[model samples]
Target: MLPRLNLRTSFQLAYRARFGWLATGSLVALLSTALLSAQFSGRQPATVALDTGLSVLRLLLSLVLVLMTQELLSREFDRRYFLNTLSYPHPRHSLLLGRFAAVAILTLGLLLLLAVALALLAWLIGQGYAQATPVALGSQYLVTIAFIGVDLLLLTAVASLLAVVASTPSFVLLGTFGFMLVARSFGAIVELLTRNTAVVTDAENYRSGIGLLGYLLPDLGALDVRMIALYGRMELLPADWPWLLLSCLVYTVGLLAMAVWALQRKHFA
Candidate 1:
């Protein structure tokens, strides 16, 4: 079923699949960030620019992931169109895997385009102000943006999984939104716990619970290195990039497998 998945057709469908709104949304986010940076009358224009740009990018991408997956999956399931598709010779897993690929490809393209636009906007804003610090266009900055793309990819996989298992679009949306918030804040939550010396009730157990959570949830904070780019602090990124990449890959694969399993057992009665 996986081998039979048509990549080209899926890519085309994804390109044409309600993508206009996503593109428009991304443009709005970009313009808003640029305008906010332009209006700021404070120190460190570069920091403000990068922070605003990245925050907008993350927000838009998160919406894209959740909404795209919900539309693609829920439209078929909710409307019972998936039954018609299953009437064909192809297996059910093909539909699930193919749609996921399509969404992933579309997401990657959107992320790259938005990242470039934001980078350019940041640069232009920096050039406009003589005293303001300009956003660095270094390799680290580009890499940081790439990491954000990876983060979106991981989140997309999770959203896809939820779309398959969830009963309705609203359920999928809420699950994905909650997952995004938890994943983004888990690192900070763990850090806060580590510093809370007042918790003298079984410190070892608390440490164990923190370690377990650290292993389970995605470390979205690790992928966020915008400060490194804004401040030209390359050392801020983890020393082992490969480890982070590996973790994301593992999580994506796990999510996809679960989505496929969920679809396999899904009844269309």
Candidate 2:
């Protein structure tokens, strides 16, 4: 009950705090980018719109997540706001969980809004002319957006964990961004090293190093199903959706647990 109340209060506060400008700016950016891409794409307007819109969505949501996490969690601790928060008649973990929930909800709301608008824009752009390969604005597109949501949520977990563990507020942003960059690029790096082994010296050692790093980080690139959305390439999907979702769930839960543990022992002074 206490956690629930905290979650509600935190969510309301977060929404009232900065969500207005964030939502406005995100929508404007998404619409402008999609419109411009469609206008210049010539024949494949819908495909180009989806591609650009998705990229913009990913980038904007990532920035919002980092900023919100820093503001709600790290900055609160930095400014000693947590002192008053900790004085509440609730466990420390509840506060952390509540704030994290608020950020997650806000991030997801933004993602949904932008995704819907992008879909509508793509559909409108494609109405004039039909390309050879029409964009999949149906289930495939929704699935792609859903995977992007999962990826962002995973990063939210990472940010939450860093918020509790990092000594300084800036580290939260730096650490989360670092994690995101590495996780997103890990697959590409591995693939490059694999396909062009002969082009580089000590390719085997590089692969071994990257393979070990893969164990420590999630392969976020695998979550990008934009190609499937853009080309309606169902074959690009993973064989087992359940397993993929399970893996992401397990990772998210683990990250949240670590965050809870860290907050429980965090010194608020």
Q: Go through the candidates in order and give each one's C-alpha lDDT.
A: 0.77, 0.87
lDDT of 1 by residue, 41-146 (tens): 5656656776787888888888887777876777678888776667778777788877777777777788888877777777776776764345567897888988
* CA lDDT, candidate 1, residue 155: 85
Model 1 sits at a Cα RMSD from the real structure of 3.0
**Cα RMSDs, all models:** 3.0, 1.6
Error of 1 at 116 (Å): 1.0
Q: TM-score for all predictions?
A: 0.87, 0.94
Task: Give me the displacement of residue 238 in model 1, in angstroms.
Answer: 1.1
Worst 10 residues of 2 by lDDT: 10-19
- Candidate 1 lowest-lDDT run of ten: 1-10
